[model samples]
Target: MTNKPKPVIGITSGDLNGIGIELIIKAFSDQRLLDFCTPVIFASNKVVNFYRKTVTESSFSFYHTREFDKINPKQVTIFNCWDEEVNITPGVLNETGGRYAVASLQAAIEAFKEKKIDGLVTAPLHKSNVQSESFSYTGHTPFLKDSFGAPDVVMMLCADNMRVALVTEHISVSAIAQHITAEAILSKLNIINSSLQKDFGISKPRIAVLGLNPHAGDEGLVGNEEQTIIAPAIKQAKNNGILAFGPYSADAFFARGQYEKFDAVLAMYHDQGLIPFKSLAVGEGVNFTAGLELVRTSPDHGVAFDIAGKDRADAGSFIQSIFFCADVINQRSEYADQRSNPMRKIAPDVVSRLADEKIEE
Candidate 1:
């Protein structure tokens, strides 16, 4: 029997001015990463070399090529998206950084379209800098949702066994409550439940839904959204055969380490979930876009402009993102394979006859 081919993971060089390149170079320096998946960085050799100079300690080199067929599985390959000369500026955000960042991402998307990559691991990108008439989505999740025609997607932050999914992300605080209808919560619940099973391989995922108000509305004294909106959503989720529970008070639940008991937690908003996760996960957290056809993951931290060129940025999260992408890709493939030819159900009469034969014997 032959061994299965490794997954081709596409890595986008996000924001040349940021620490994304540093993290990428640092993560691949170990070389053992190439054994799990073939890494294809969607950036030019010149751009990668610019940051490679800062991380002089790492002896990471890449196979520079513009063609897809030239990608080396055993080595890192830089898929040059552009050939023109561009100025490099660390710790500064500019239009050029955003422009090239978009170029790298679009190139990776094209590779996905051609079925060249199995999964994608993106570096951090400044949301404001990348905004234009063509790309107007808040972050990668929305852009990918539109690109793939996904009806809905969940921005899931994962670290170790702890997973937190948000119902609303990158929106104003005032607008969060208005968006927290039962339908929206139930939709997120379904997506989170499905992802836990298919992406993470949880057989029966138990989802803990957090409340929208303090003390879960304290029996509707502080706010009624928990009782009126969130509770109803959890009920509807259970009706749909989802093991969903609670409009639990977010603060107390996390303080008491209640999340450890459940498979996943569904936060009402972005910060409500991320604050605790970032605090707990620190440098090892990974942001996974759940409910997408393609597997995409990113480091939980953003572009650290302060430490961009100082070589102080840790590659733990970025490396974790790579491993997470491979795990999800394999999990999805295995899950699909198991479902492809399911065992036929035994007929009632056949079962009864077998039972009677056993009894007679």
Candidate 2:
């Protein structure tokens, strides 16, 4: 029997007080999105309806489905997880909203694990609220990694055609120095390389590694981490036959569109990469969790509590998340097809696979 077209995407409604509902409403408003993949929202009909009334009374219709088999892409399909009545108050954080948001995420994750959904495109969830309601985790990336038992996971934020992968995430600036070791850097680089080749379809991805210090430690004049830690990691990555280069200065590297030269940049810290990345591609950036067992993507921006219900939230990033998810899904499908095809022959030494010894030792 032929396999059915499984392009169903699960979208988790973020915090009720945030722009999650607004963006979801706006993104699905476009009928063209249905042409690419079937979107299954893991939310409540009551919540979505109330959001529509508060934000845009466009008279759009949504079909409620309890199961994935009942999804119809031609119309908006919502999986009702909440059986009780919900009060949809935009721009207000409450216990009910927090619980509901966590429920939606859990439902989507279960569906993905069951193979009912092809990929997941999360809206935005308030970290504090989610932690209070559900199990405490670092962020979406770590949550997904733990959920799927993915050993190595990378958080990549992309905007304006520039992509950056975070080496150390969800930690303070002072803690980043201790976290920046040669082993950690090399491991992240491996994840980035595999993700680019498999999910991104980049045959030979040239990746740039950013230095942790100013002016790349001025060649050890300022700090020796560049020479001792970062440089050695890059050298090891190069020896592994990965096209990895540099420990470029974080400040001057982004100027003159230098980031465009490489496929992706490995940032040593969170703000060091995200500040410039967001500055260039704030509303349009898509935050992608690479090296996951399943495809997962989200809007680069966070919950905009200030303008949640004002109809002022831009859906650009949310829309970009959907598009990026679709793109990655297609890339993965194509790669799988190529691998299964008998006529296709992959080069033996093209991409080096890291052994257990390399990863552990």
Candidate 3:
């Protein structure tokens, strides 16, 4: 059989002080990874070697390049972002590592903007230290939203089986109720629905939305948000021909496996969805930024400061992210093909009427 075209996946080496480089090196060590797609690391070769030497005795190497033209799809390529030598330390938080993380990320994003890479797989970044004068933002999600000029995007966490999205992310718990209006919920629901179809290749996806309050507001006894805001949003979603449901009690939804029935779930706040998703995902999930024109996924976990140089980081999620990006890109291509040359999927009633007319004729 002939080989299929592979997407060039650009990788941003996040926060050099952490396990970002370790995971990036370990994940790409396996030669079989190149069979799926090419990976280009956006970091200095010196930093990558520092992590490799600090953590391992192995001799894994990446071809260094000055520009995108030098990329080879069969092996690893390090797109040198930093010119001069920089301090490379493990498990130490400083401005140097933080600057490098954002530098690498920004370079990879520019590569993405130029269409040099198909998808991006970013390693973990320290939220506190990664802040720079030019890169001051809550996190990657908002920065990416502004970078791409997208009006809105969803912070979705995806695993093999479970997918959960947040309505309000990186915010205070007290601020959640204020943001959980009918409009916000409906907007998230719509984004989820669209991403499911276009990004995830789900046809008429079923989404379950979680409520803001305990027991989903207890029908106004516990709170009024669910009864007034959430339910109305669900109503609007259904009316818009979206397979949306819920105002489901967040506590009971996952307790009884109610999430298994749907393609995706929308939670009211950060912890409401993430706590359960993390507990259930068991360190195997991938944080995907849904509703963007490009595909981006990162290791679900964060910068493991304590275990930075231990060579103990698990590259499972990172590897899965690479494969998932490939799958999502393929799914998107197939979805576009189907849309452009849609299949004969007429409504059942319309088909019956046509059949009856033919018989009568």
Candidate 4:
């Protein structure tokens, strides 16, 4: 039904010991998925074979590509990120896992820079182990932000039922207040609104902005952030032609089920949005990096070291992540074309003339 060219999705295998490879293997086992998009995994052949022999139940075909021109569209292919000798441990956390994780990601990023790949889907990596001189940020979002020199970015957690973005992520709770300035809030809103329009193909997005304190700050009794910073930013965003709303109290907002009415929700901090999001849609949620020039997504869950080799880690989120990336790529392509030649608005007289012409025909 779709005539669009298949996007080559670049997947970065996360911590070698984690369930990242297992998730990738399980998701790609079905050949029919190839009809949707081409997958080019950035990993070593030995590491993949180890996973196939150890964890997976069925065979997954992969072509080892010496060059991007050799990548096959019908079959999954390994991009040959590194040729270094390595050992595969299922459940242990070590420095080696981080090293390859970085290697795979850097190779994919280079390809993305060169326009060899359409988008990226990253597997889970442990926060502590994935550190390097090149990647010192907390997680995937900041690293991508800095790598591309993006001024700022939004970490949006999206599922079938809900879409929530954070104003702040991976920052200390005590320091959250200091960062909740009007500028930060407004910038995030701009990102969320723009992403909802271009990335997700939403025409007019209605966003809900949640409060930082309890009980909507009880009219400044609980916290002054709602009055001093959050509200002013919402006003500024609305003035800028964004359909943004709220300073909504998180408790009543979710408990009363008010989120169902909006296109997206913006939270003040990490736990404020993620706690409820995970509870409602953990296995289905996809972590999307909004406001970046390049498209990237990941499974909402982290490196589950406990279930590394147990074959218990669910591939649902990762599968969704791939499909989401594909959809975004298609939408972004259309968005670019539309932006270049935007639709001309029809006036009342033009509409009447068109109706008259149709009647005459």
Q: What is the Cα-based TM-score of model 3?
A: 0.93
Task: Write the residue-wise lDDT of candidate 3 on 1-361 in tens digits.
Answer: 2445898998999988889999988988888889998899999898888788765645567899888897888779999998798877788888887888899989989998899999999888878887767988878899899999987889999997799999999988777788888887888888899999998878789999888888888878889988888888899989999988888999899999999999999998998899999999988899999878889999888888888888989988899888988888877876776787665233545878999999999
Pairs in clash, predicted candidate 1: none
Expressed as tens digits, the lDDT of each residue in 131-222 for candidate 1 is: 99888978899999998999999999999859999999999998999999999999999999999999988889999999999899999999
User: Every model's Cα RMSD, please?
Assistant: 4.9, 7.7, 4.9, 3.4
For model 1, give the 10-residue run with minimal summed lDDT.
Answer: 341-350
- Candidate 2 C-alpha lDDT tens digits along 171-271: 97778899999999999999999889888888899999999889999988999999999999999999999999999999899986889899999999999
lDDT of 1: 0.92
TM-score of each: 0.94, 0.91, 0.93, 0.94
Cα deviation at 57, candidate 4, in Å, is 2.5
Candidate 2, position 171, lDDT: 90
Model 2 ranges with Cα > 4 A deviation: 1-6, 57-59, 342-361
**Better by TM-score, candidate 4 or 3:** 4
lDDT, candidate 3, equals 0.87
lDDT (0-100) at residue 182 of candidate 3?
87
- Distance from true position, residue 164, model 2, in Å? 0.6
C-alpha lDDT of all candidate models, in order: 0.92, 0.85, 0.87, 0.90
Model 3 weakest lDDT span, ten residues long: 340-349
